[model samples]
Target: MVVLMRRRLVWALAFVLVLSLTGQEDTAKKPARTISIVAERFFFSPSKIKVKEGETVEFVLTSDDTDHGFHVPAAGIDVAIPPSGKGEARVRFTAIKKGNFRFECSRACGAGHNLMRGEIIVR
Candidate 1:
């Protein structure tokens, strides 16, 4: 009877440890906010983005049909998104004044290379 009680106690302690570990894992896996940007033939979807001041945003950039690059000139951020492959970048900035920031694909695309531009409005 003593041996059986000890076995039960061991199992209960193990179960509690497992539950504590799981709770910690859940807290560590909290999701981060994301902003999706699609790069297609020659344009950036939405053409403009609006983001809150001082918010950390994960930019999930994807290219649809061809290889492309996402470059923010003002921020000096450049990341290439391969065709059909997902890429990610991040930006967090505080806005003291309202203005438009220009962004474009630095990579030389086809005829519309110069036209591939977008803006970010911060307020």
Candidate 2:
């Protein structure tokens, strides 16, 4: 009886371990949420975005007018966005901290370049 109980306990522990590992794998394999952003002279559409902490996000950037850039210093993201009808740029990052991060244009577009900014709110 003692041997049988020991064997069953070992099997139960192994089962629990497998379940925990599988859960972790599922979390790691989760796909990042994609957010499309439009950049034009002076401002970015949807200037404020909210995301969950620890979530992965992808930003697809496009410009409607002249060339521009997407710069997020806190997240270490900087990408150039081509002009309208040219092409686009993509950046991906994980929101590990819960706070607000600022993003702006790295390239000079016009007099309003400084106003071309946005915020990412991580909750």
Candidate 3:
């Protein structure tokens, strides 16, 4: 009877350990969410965005009329968006900080290039 009880305890402990490890694995393997942005001559569609801290995000930038750029100084993200129907630029970064990060057009598109700006709010 003593030996049987010891075996049962060992199995129970092993099962609990496996369950804990699997839970951690699922969290670690969580997929990142993708956000698409459309850039025009003077503005970005959906200029404001919100994300959770410690979550990963992927940005897909595309142009409508001319060549534009995406620049996020705080997050170290910089990419050039091609012209309409040409192609797109993609960037991925983890939101580690909790604040607002500004993004703007890196390339001079036109006279209103300065107005082309957006913000990513991380909470």
How do all models score by TM-score?
A: 0.64, 0.75, 0.74
Off by over 4 Å in 2: 1-31
Model 3 over residues 3-113: C-alpha lDDT tens digits? 967855664564455445434534454437879999998999879989899887767778898888888899656676767876666666578889999999988999999
TM-score of predicted model 1? 0.64
lDDT of 3: 0.78
Candidate 1 residue pairs in clash (backbone atoms < 3 Å): none
Q: Is candidate 1 or candidate 3 better by TM-score?
A: 3
Candidate 3 worst ten-residue window by lDDT: 22-31
Report the number of the highest-lDDT candidate.
2
Query: Where does model 1 exceed 4 Å of error?
Result: 1-32, 85-97
**Local error of candidate 1 at 56, Å?**
1.8
Q: Report how far off residue 89 is in candidate 3 (Å).
A: 0.6
Clash pairs (backbone) in predicted model 2 = none
Deviation from truth (RMSD, Å), model 1: 15.9
Worst 10 residues of 1 by lDDT: 87-96
CA lDDT of 51 in candidate 2?
88
